[model samples]
Structures are given as structure tokens and as C-alpha cells.
Target: MSVAAPPPSETTIADSAQNPSMNDLVTEQLVSSGDAASFAPRTALALLHYDVASTILTDLTPNELLNFALTCRSICNVVIPRYIWAHIALTPKHPRLQVITLLRKIAFSVECGPHFIRHLEVASIHVKKPYLKCRNPWYLPYLFQELFTQMQNLRSLSIIHCDKMLPHLPRIPKAIVSLPHLRSLHLANFSYLALNLLDKLSGLQTISLASPTYNVHEFLSSTTSALQKILVNSRHTLEEIRLFEVCLNVDLIPSHHGSRADADTNQELCWPHVHTLELPQCIGDGWAPALHIAFPSVRTFASPEQSHWWTAALRDASFLTGLESLHTKSSVARGFTMAGYTTRRLVIGDDMPFDVTNTPLKDLLPRHLVNLQVSLWSSYFDPTLERFTTVLPMVTPHLKYFFMRMNRGFICNTYHNQLCDIVDDIRTLPLEYLCITWDVNCGKKRCDRCVRRSCPEPVAKYVERRLPSLQALTIRVDENRRWHWKKKKVEEDGVPAGTLSLMSPTREGDILREEYAKRIV
Candidate 1:
């Protein structure tokens, strides 16, 4: 029986968390007192050259990178010279003093280190008072100003949960305008008054506004004018916008004394380069941008609800001529299908317990769809095996990319014939990339029937034989593990020849479903 390993214990977790970086392992001893830089040729860590190791180290967190640097002098030198802190993600859960210390180091660094930091994400930086002994009233403002002003070369900045930070660090708006290289900005939980810098900063490429915890009506109404001004100023350079729970009021900004528009009327503006837009669900909500704006180059559109566009360009155009993909819920997808709207790429992620529109796909799906992504996170009481039975066969055989996340009982582990039947259904797809993550219940189950027949390998083999154009296959049998099969070979490590890969709950994030969609505009 080939069984995956059980979950890790507390001691094993404590030991593994200390050495998290995937940088080439440092050779503790070069076997000589004077040759600390050299490694034995036979060592596995010796395989990666210095440049590759340095590049890989950039992926580590600030703390992890520092810990890895402490291993040896050679690695310490590498960390000091390179742009290892190009990306920094800070959350309230992180040690406050440690983060402040790192920020201070970057601000005063002699390596021009602050210039190398391209992306910064500060999430939920509000209301969590630090327990530090230094109780100076001006401490946060000074620290933030020093750190932010020195990051003049930053490319992307994401600041969320900062409604309280404004009271302490009001100079952040000025600091944002000081960056010449900044193009992407993400803000959440801020008032319209906080967005005055939007007019001062132009040439932005991406803007994402989210208000997860605020009143929708109040936030939207307050931010509409500021949002419109920013859009008009950055029209030439803006390429993507993602709005969550903050939709612009469809009416034009009521004339203010010295606003950008003239005398209660404005000229039409066109976003000639905007390629992707993700708006929140807009089903029965009564707000659509009333501005005379056009997104002529929008290639991908995602909204969770039905939409009614009143913009002159959208209303006049026969269809979204440039749109290649549509992402929405099952009910909205059905509405689009019923309205005769079709696209080559489609994504349906409806997390409803019972959706009547879900069955419409059983009878018809867009025949020309080249890429399909479906999320069946239905109730655990009801497995999506039935939906799979109906929809998988309907997908075009010529489709190239397919992604699905579903909860099916360990029927594959207990009933081989049912697994074979499921594989036979989707076998005709000439899929170049296929990803499936089977969502299992949290409860325990035991498969005592000598495990090879109870595992997913036989099903994968059956799939590989049935689909000739298959290029890459990834299957996550349970939450903790996934394996890839290519060229008739399965990358199953640390298990018997009969078993799949050992379940590494300690590894990293879920590898099953993150890569199915293209992100960049």
C-alpha cells in the first residue's frame, strides 16, 4: 500500500521554519580554515552558482533573508550587494519592532538599498497599537516619512487599512507624489479626502481601490469625484483597474468651485491603452459611470453580477470587440449566454449553495471557448461530481487550458471504476495544461485496500493515454499534496514506486489552482 505521510508534529514544524529560504544551501565548512568560500563539488547545495542563488534569495521574506544571510560570510556578502529586498510585504501580525528596524536600515543604507525596493505592501496598518516603550507622539510620522521619502524609485505601493494612519502620518500623500517611478497603487479603507494626491500624481499604470469594511453607499459617493479626476489625469498611462466594493456613482461629479471639468459639462475621454478591468458585482445596483469615457482596448472584463453599461462608446458599439475573456458567477454567466454575449475565454466562480443557472451549462456552453475555468466550491454535503459529469463532456475538445477545483469524495481512492468513468468523460480535450485539485472533507478516512489501486496514479495514466495533446497535468488528491505528470513520468518524491508524492503540509501555499489565469495586463 502506497500511503502519503501524515501531518507534521510541533517539533518538526519548529525545526523547519528556521531554514525557509530556498537559496542554495550554504556549505558550513569548505573543509579548510582559509577556504570558507569554497564548497565540495559533491554537495547538492554546490550545484547553484552565485548569481542563481542570489536571484532565488529575493523570493524570501525580509526575516527569512536575514536569517539565511547569517549562515555564512559568502551569503552575507551576496545579500548586502544585491536587490534582495525588491519586494516587501508587511502585515500587522509581523513583529512591529523588527519591521520598523528593517525600514530604518533601508532608509539609512549606504548600498542605496531603498532605491532597490520596487514593491511595498502594507496591509491592515491601522488600529493595532504597538507595545513599544518609545511613546513619542511624533514617532510614527517621522518613521514613515523617512522610510517612504527614501523609496523614490518604488514601482508599486499597496496601502490598506490605513484610515487611522492618516491621523499620525499625513505626509504619506506627499511622499506618494514624490516617487517618479511609481506606476501601480492599491488603496483600501480611505476617505475621499485622503485621495487628494491622485490629482498630483500622474502616469500611473494600475489602480486598485477596495473598501472591504466600509459602507458602500457612503464610500462610493465620497470618492467619486477624486476617482474621476485621477482617471482623467492618468488616462494616457493607465492600463488596468480593479475595484472591489467601490463603484463610481454613474452621475457626473456635481460641479465644485475649481474642479477639472468646466461648467457642469465635460468632453469625452478615451482609455486607449486600458486592457483589463475588474469591477464588483453590479446586478441591481443603480450606479454606472455617467462619464463620456471609453475603454477601447479592454481585453478582459470580470464582474460578479449582471451589468448594464450606459457609456456612449459601449452603447454604440455592437459588442466589446476587443474583449477576449469574461469572468463572473454562474447566474451572471447564464444571463450573458441568454443575452447572446459570447467570448473565447470564460471563468465561472459561483460560490452559491444552490444556483439554478448552474444547470444551464449542462445544455450549452460557448462552443468557441478556448480557455475555461470553473470553481465548484459548493456545499460539502453535495459533491460536484454530478456537475462534472454534465459539464466536462460539453467542453470543446480543442480547448487548450482547463482548470477546476472541486470537492469529490475519496471515491477515486475507494472505487477505481468510477474514477475511470470520470477520466473517460474529459479525455477528448487536447489540453496543453490541466490542473485539478480535489477538495476533500476535513474528517478522517482510511483506505486499507492495498493502496496502488486506491491512488490517483492509475487514473492519471488512464488520462494520459486518452488525451494525446496533453502537455502538463497536475492533480492534488488531498489538500496537502499535488503531483505533476508529463511525458509518461510522474514527479512523486519521498514515496514508494507505487505511491504518489509524500504530503508536505509544511511546504508552501496551495499549488493546485493559482496559475490557471493570466494576471498581467
Candidate 2:
């Protein structure tokens, strides 16, 4: 006690030499007998009995689940569930023959038979190289029919990019028409087959057709009566229709007396339950006045292309007046006044010109907008950021979420002070969520000030000081150094107010840039 007992380390070693403890005896027994029970209880098996663990296993991908099942015997028993093999995708890049063989094996497996495939996608079909080759080119059709007939529970089907199958239009498989539970269908670049398929499926709730090679105007004219019958049959169940890079003629719609009469007397065909309509920008001007008449209940309208037709449609007094969400290019939105429009969410593309005068943000944006997403394609300069700041006060009162995505080479030369200033300006607004994403350039000649690791410090401090109402803030510097700032209202102090994590870099270039903003919170 007087000399601290020669320190605990030295005393412990001396005491151990005199008398070994229970731990030492157990180690000796384990080494001599090679028995696992001498150390600890078999608690790993207990994890399989937990509900939380089962929920986690359900979230794993198909390949990951397979790997986890093979890790040990106990996990394999818990991992083999029918829901894990419900969705199957077969693409062109991989060997289709091998994939089909595997699918056939899974379909007839004694343990998990038949009803395994609920959603099936045959994507990237290159007409040049059919999935199955033989002396008879029509063999693939029969094979597809057989596969579809076997999967009785198939509910969703997608066939895309089959341009080379135009010559085999009539020979396309018809098994899809007989699916009792098929609720959704997506077809692209297969005009004849798509029309034929639509004529057969009367219970579909969702239909998406894109860039059909057939002349839409001529086809509609020739099959106006059949199209009317299909529309009438699906009026009760159809809820969404997406048309991309194609124009629909309004005159072809069946009307009272089978003729176009005065607006007061003419009764247009209407889908009472349909609320979502996605139209291409190339839709004709004659279709503008008939939009609301045809879809009186439409609430969400999207223009997926960059064309002036959507702007023209918005100008019509008879166009859809109850739209709650709109997706359009910034260029098309210029010179349009959405003051009377009730749209609450707006998504603007990045292809707008840099000049703010051409596409005035404050004038074009609706006052009721609660969520705003803007894309910036400016590779070398970010002129839109400064212009957007000028209009923040106008949208500050109602806006709740703001998301901005910038393309490559956009933030390589930006300094910490610029980010701090932007955050300071944003703090004046009452935003609940904010997300900013840009590609980080790590080239050799990059600016030293820009590459400094403490770039996000000032921005984080500003949010902590100026924006007390902020709930969540996320900033990504490419695939690495993603900074997240979240407020925990229940905690008082000592806990970190924000967190910055460094993650491994992901895929490169345009594709990665598009996906960077979509990472989980």
C-alpha cells in the first residue's frame, strides 16, 4: 500500500506464478482436449431463432443470400425461403441459354416448385442474336410460350429492345395473353406485338409502351374501333399509362354519335379511375384540349422528353388543372406562368441554358411547390447555383425538401469558402431536408485548396449555428468522403451534432454520377 504494491502488472504476474486462476485452468483443458464447450456457450445458433435476424436475412440480394446459406449448416436451413426466388431477370449480356437452363431447373425443383417466379423480365433482347438459336428461327417463340405457360403465378412481364423481331411479329408467343394474374406489362420497340398484346390483356392495371417503330397515327386510324373496345374493357382497372417518344391522336378516341361535335354535346371516353398519365413531348397540339376531357381525374402528369408541346399544353385553359406533380425540362418551362396550377412537386432537368433570364426560376416555379429537384449539367461552371440562391426567398415558405445533382468536373475547382457561403444563404430558409451531390475529381493537377480534407467543417458549423430547424443534411464528395449532418432533438449535448464518413469509391463516369444521389440515407 505504501509503494502502490509494486504496480498491478508486476504483482499480477508474480501471483499468477504462485497460483493459476480458473481462466488458466480452462485454457489448459481446452488445449489438451480440443473441446469448444470449455470456452463459451453455442450462442451463434441462437441468432437463427431471433425474429430480427430473419428480417435482416430477407433484405439480402439473391446472390448474397446464396453465399450466406453456403457459409454453414445452421444458416442454410433458415435461408431457403420461397420469397427469395420470386423475381428473375434474364438479360442479353449474359448467356441466355445458360440462364434459361437454370430457370428450368428451378421451376421443376422438388423442394421449390412452380410458383417461384412472380416477376420475370426478358430485357435487352437483340434481334440479331435470339435467346435460343436453331434451324427453325421460330423455335424461340414456342420455347417462350412453354416457359410462360409453366409459370402460373407470373404477375409482371417486361420485354424490351427487340427491334430485330419485327419480321417475326405474328410468330411472337401468345402465352402471356392467358396469364390470369398478370397486372403490369411493359413493352418497348415492339409495336405490332405491343398492340396485339394490349388487345388480349383486359385486366392490366399498368401499361408502359415506348418508342414503337410502327406509325402510331396510321395504326390508330386502322384500329380505332378495336382501340375503343380495349379502352372500354380496361376502364375500370387501368390506373397508369406511360407513353414515351410517341404521339397519340385525340381524334381517334370514340365519342358520342361516333363524330366530333360541339364541346357541350360531345361526350369523350374517360377512364374514371386512372390518375397517372405520362406523355411524350411530341404529342400533337390537337391532343391538348382533349387531355382533361379524356382523363378528368388525372393528378400526376409527366413529360419525359425535352420538347415545347408540354409548354403549349400547359397554356390551354382546358388542360389538366388538378395536377399535383410535374416532371419537365427547364427549357420547356420558360415563359410559362404556373401561378394558377396546383402542382406541389417539381422536377427540372439539367439541360437548361446557363442564362437565368431565359428560364426564370422564380417566375416559372409554382408557389405551392413543397419539393424541388434540379439537375445541373454544367461540367466546368455552376452559374445556376448563384441564380438559384436569388429565388430561395420566394420558395422558402412552402419548400420542405431540396435536392441538387451536379455532373462531372463541376466541383473540382470549388473552394471551402464557396460551400460555406451557400450553406449560410440556405440557413435563412426553413428547409427540413437538403441533399447536394457532385462528382469529386482526384486528378493530379487539382487545386490544393479544393482538395483539402477540412472542406466540410465550415459548412457543418454553419448548419449547427444558423439552421436549428434543419432535420437532415447530406453532402457527397464523389464516392468518397460523404458528409451527413442529422439533428437528434432528444439528445442534449456531448454527442456529435454531425458525422462525416469515408466510403470506398464506386463505379466511375456518367452512370455513377447519376446514381450518387440515390444512395440510402
Q: Judged by TM-score, which candidate is best?
A: 1
lDDT of 2 by residue, 109-224 (tens): 21222222222322111122334443454545555444545655556767775544423544444555666777776767755544555565578788776666666556655655
Task: Write candidate 1's Cα lDDT for 1-521 as tens digits.
Answer: 01112222322212222322322323322231244443332222323554455456555555454433433323343442332333344333546454444333333232323222222322111223322224454554575566566556677777765555543466777777776777888877765666655457778899877763444466554444566677767779999977766544431222121225453343335566878877765323444432223566788878635444322224323335456887876665665555555677878866432232336563334666777777654443333345453355564545677777665445334444544555566777666667766654333355454232234676567666776666556666565466665442443444334322323342321342344455211
- Tell me each candidate's RMSD, in Å, in order: 10.7, 14.0
Evaluate residue 466 in candidate 1 and report its C-alpha lDDT on the 0 to 100 scale.
70
Tell me how candidate 2 scores on lDDT: 0.51
Best by lDDT: 1
> Which pairs clash (backbone N, Cα, C closer than 3 Å) in model 2?
none
List the candidates' TM-scores in order.
Answer: 0.67, 0.66
lDDT of 1 at 223: 46
